[model samples]
Target: MAEGILRPLGSSDLRLSPLGLGCWQFSKGRGLVGKFWPVLEDSVIRDIVRTSWEGGINWFDTAEAYGGGQSEEMLADALSALGEAGRGAHVATKWWPIMRTAGNIGKTIDERLRRLKGWPIDLYQVHQPYSFSSAASEMHAMAKLVQQGRIKHVGVSNFTADKMAEADKALREHGLRLVSNQVKYSLLDRRIERNGIMEAAKELGVAIIAYSPLEQGILSGKFHSNPELVKQISGPRKWSSGFKPEALNRTRPLIDRLNELADKYGASPSQVSLNWLIHAHGETVFAIPGASKPHHAQENVNAMRFTLSQEEIGELAELADRSKR
Candidate 1:
């Protein structure tokens, strides 16, 4: 596959690969949420990171809450192992907002910088909107970090449309802009489109950072073809309705369309799904798909090598809309 293209993230000077490597799985199953994934070997983690960097992925997204900050440390270690090769990679990590006031944003920013070995953070985000402090307060804190030169850009995740707008206004008060909103967006989950989030993002000029672009591998057509494989899934995915036989049956037509497109584009079903996202709304959308293995990273980068036709994109969108109804 050819090298992936980099694009501007919202109105920021920071450029990101159309596809980013998500480091949530690097937690190695250590934290409360990390227990859902099987422990991965350090060598495997390094390989995945190395592969992603070499495969043309320039940005990585991780969180402080992911495996209790282990994900940040592991990502740092993996990138450090690359020496000069990883120097230009942009790293985006989030601050967990649960049970904390806006003041905690600055306090935790120090810890996140420490855990990342003092590497510059390209985009620092509030992981979720469930905070004791108001959105305005939290964004003001994030804007402060940007002023301090700790984070290049400020972002948020899982924020509602109104809250996103409020956060943007708050950041503007500090002479900054909310660059992105990271949320779960995929062919299977299109809540952002129905809800006001997508519209707000476009109106506010904030990029939508799409996580789980493959719908936790459902769009890959793995569990649908082999129901037995669903038993081996760990974490919250095992309990997802998408893994159920009936749900799979209901989605068969959509999966079939994805597969058909995959064949036409000479790509995998997951690639087809991810490509759809990056091309969905011009440059307004980006995808961060996790790579548990080296080849997974390679496959993800390859997704950008080809572009889907407008007609093909429309057809897939129609299928997805019908499935939802």
Candidate 2:
């Protein structure tokens, strides 16, 4: 029964689930890759998407850079399986800033549309500010699409406050506004708070779609130990004793606290971390935690099943602050 929590996305007319399933992991495909840096198969991916919808998640985030469009294709694949309800799912996708040419933008959007197979993307965003030229050109292209109704709204990711303001101002010139900036934010990384991205987003009426919201799984408590877990769960890292061990020790206590809290609430560590994010920023903030399994998807959906108290939120914030230093 973890449904009915809808938050306004800044000034946009749209609303989203507190926790949306990210489609980035679908690039790995199934098998050994699925186990170690896994991606679900089409069949399983379909089930997971549907299960997420059943679990009350109405939003999904994907990018063209993920698996060379495999993520979008898989999202489209999942939509083909959902029938009517799938059509209503809010989708947020990105265009690489480097691919900013009008022709290239058309091609990229077409490619994404082909993969999505006509699901009607609710939000389309620029992946990042790759360069000044690409950034400026892509902003215009996004505006053109908004005018043509190919995309519902415009967004940008990995943008700083200055770039966000620039992009917003640029789009506003065309009678449009960038709706969100997807970035890496979690207990481990709060750079947005210092960099003015959060405050600027508040000022500009743009939401922040926090990717890697779990810190590449570091904040999820799964990477608390063993060099192999990092490699197996995260990705291959060059072997170095000093590096891995240090990261482990620093993160261990946080994970321990997360585990303790998880047990008390009967929630997984990932859920706790995401819940913390929800409590940290309220509704304008959303987390997109990817999964390669139905159960993991289920656990992520369970994130909104409980609420943390103000005192607990404060304690976690203090712990995160200490861990940062």
Best by lDDT: 1
Candidate 2 per-residue lDDT, tens place, 110-160, comes to: 777787778787889878677446455677878888888888888888998
What is the C-alpha lDDT profile of model 1 across 32-140, one tens digit per residue? 9888677788999999988888888988899998898899999999899889867988899999999999999988787899989967899999999998999999988
What is each predicted model's overall lDDT from 0 to 1? 0.90, 0.78
| TM-score of each model, paired residue for residue | 0.97, 0.89
Per TM-score, the best of the predicted structures is 1
Tell me how far the alpha carbon of residue 298 in candidate 1 is from the true structure, in angstroms, after superposition.
Answer: 1.0
lDDT of 2: 0.78
Q: Report the Cα lDDT for candidate 1.
A: 0.90
Runs in model 1 lying further than 4 Å from the true structure:
1-3
Clashing pairs in 2: 34-38
